[model samples]
Target chain A: MYQTNQLADATINKSESAVDVQPDLNQYLMAVASHQDKAAFAKLFAFFAPKIKAFGLKQFRQEALAMDLVQETMSLVWRKAQLYSPEKGKASTWVFTIMRNYSFDMLRKIQHNKEDNLSDDLWPLYEEAEPEPDYEDDHLMREQLIQGLEALPPKQKEVVEAIYLKEMTHQELAEHLGVPLGTIKSRLRLGLEKLKEKMELHND
Target chain B: MIKHHPESTMIHAFVAGELPASLSIAVSAHLELCPHCKAIADKATKAMADEFSGNEALVELAEPTPAQPVDEFATMLAAITEQPTDAPALKSAAVESSNQMALGEKTYTLPRALRQFSQTKWSGLGNIQRARLGLDEGDVHASLLQIDADSAIPHHTHKGYELTLLLDGCFEDESGRYEKGDFIILNGEHHHSPYTAEGCLCYTVSNAPLHFTSGVSKLLNPIGRFLY
Candidate 1:
């Protein structure tokens, strides 16, 4: 937790060895809420900042701007700890909402034009396809999601698995199901929505 | 009478962000001319990102308590809320079906107070039975009619408020094409025939009884009155 000139200078390069806290991000967020824990905040800052940066660069196309957005997003998260209703959404969802909400605002201000911040060393998120799913620890989550899907009504689950998991084209799915294309699509939308509600409840 | 035509399939693709640049351009142009589609597209755009890859989400490493996380969420939410507040979130995630689908833009989220139905033990009615979120059940009971795409609604009139939220797909009325997330509020004065283009899942919450357009629809009267 030491922050001096040397530590500040080397932290980024040494981040490779930064303790990975992928296991208890939600707990960490709760800790921040329980006690104004600066350490926990810093840990979160180090972890999410990079991801936020990548997302921002996608929207703004500038490293500095992305970084600024990250800083702002994290700062907001820090301030909104009281509103962290785990019952409503997962920690990740809350965090993502912050970024998405901010970007939406930024998009509005920029009017869909690319932000020309002219910074070096950054990459757009979408262009660099997301990393392949790592099953190492996320298996529980994946299973939980699958189980949740099973718990949905038969029709709803069918639409969700087909559209979201299998990525079946609507027409293919419609023809295959012998239902109208519109019915398939609407069912898919409704099914996922139901699943999201269930998942949020399970996590809560 | 809308300036742009709806393409349910393209909208589905656009929502998934899988449509080609050319298709996207056309969809985007259509969205500019159409607000309903814009609304559905907006939710689907975000939902798609959330579904495929939750990269944007932050894993909960530790819990923040008492904490005093920053209060920035409110301001940002306020800002978002301020951005035209015309768009409504989908009740259940709305499916885009085809990439060319165009959605509606005036959905209003029902308040928790209004959502009083048990998730368990719900029934269907005439292929569109609702689970009664306790919500507009009274009203919904009166006018809840869901039509598959390309199917025709009885083309009825209303006695009071007819608020229709296109949960998925769309139907055409004299006013125009109504798509997912689009809200159509009709009063007793308005009368139109609503037909699903191909297949649409519409959630029409109405407080008033639907007076059928034709005398033949009057046959629906004896039974339909009890329906409401």
Candidate 2:
């Protein structure tokens, strides 16, 4: 079971048809977001409610709780549709995140008898991941990093070298250099600022 | 270096939202500090989404009839559309506050998962201080544990499972040194005294209390519930 799940995780949905499905859903979601288009929302609800219910049933194993999960999650989708951005992820992923969160909170309520809604606190729906750069931008950044490394002062350069080049964690580097962790952090901060400046300067 | 991590199966379960909050928060805190684990979590989440997307055929089999009929869907949509969307309450990611804890003169930045219990007070004995998170996980307990510099925790083993994610500084046990972002899960078979040179803060969750193993520390076994 574990091996299958791990294998499934490794093989992401890369098919063209699978890729094609996301944009259409994104459009429907956008329609719902821009205008309170009930038709667009209805489409989403029709598509997602069963899946959410299916997921909830697997997790909760009780019929009423599963139904409640569907209601709560769909209602949330209706309300929070505007927050969805294609840059963040596909529409299905967004809905899955919401469904799983509700499922988690419901379990907490039932098992622990804790009424506090801690799901959002643990996994903030609005929080976005750091924007990923495409391959070209990555190459450009590497070039800038080399130039940036050259421009750094000896002390700051060593910290950046150890961190980015050698992939040494701040704690490890501190221990390696026999310096306080605070000293390593300060050097890293300064070094990072210089690197960012170099990148921005190259861009300009 | 982060030598220890939660198992891959654990990460999958975490992404699937199968773990209890007590255990989930420990993973969340570790993910905040470990980019490697974060990448794995992101992939798992994506795969979960794909699974849901692809399960339309299976969903039909599992769910023979629509739970909510087409007509009721319209009603729910109308009701939902009528409601005002809530603005996000906490901009936790961008708006940083003093979500930190002090162990003596030095303060360490608490992870986002722990920010909720930032105000909890600390109680201590000797070179150790602990703040319970008040998570209602039955037998399970979650806490922020602080070890003062040049101090050693009594040699002990877990009764069930103990998951400790180092939030700051470093500590070494008989097995190895654990630094920030290390996710170390110890079972009953493992027994060691953790000592730190610069002191450290950790988010620890355990299903059962510690069993002090040796000498004078064995006296602490009776009060282990309070200490763990």
lDDT of 2 by residue, B29-76 (tens): 777676678778888998899888763311111222578455544555
Overall lDDT per candidate, in order of appearance = 0.51, 0.76
Per-residue alpha-carbon lDDT of model 1 for B49-94, expressed as tens digits?
Answer: 4542243333323444566674443333334323231112321122
Best by DockQ: 2
Q: What share of the true interface contacts does each candidate keep?
A: 0.00, 0.39
Q: Model 1's CAPRI class? A: incorrect
DockQ metric for all predictions: 0.03, 0.20
Q: Which candidate leads the pack in TM-score?
A: 2
Model 1 C-alpha lDDT per residue in residues A1-204, reported as the tens digit of each score: 222333334444434455422223444565566654555565566567667778889778987778668766776677655456433334555576666656644653454243421110011111112223223343577777878888888987887776665455565466446689889878888888887887888789
RMSD of 1: 19.4
* DockQ for candidate 1: 0.03
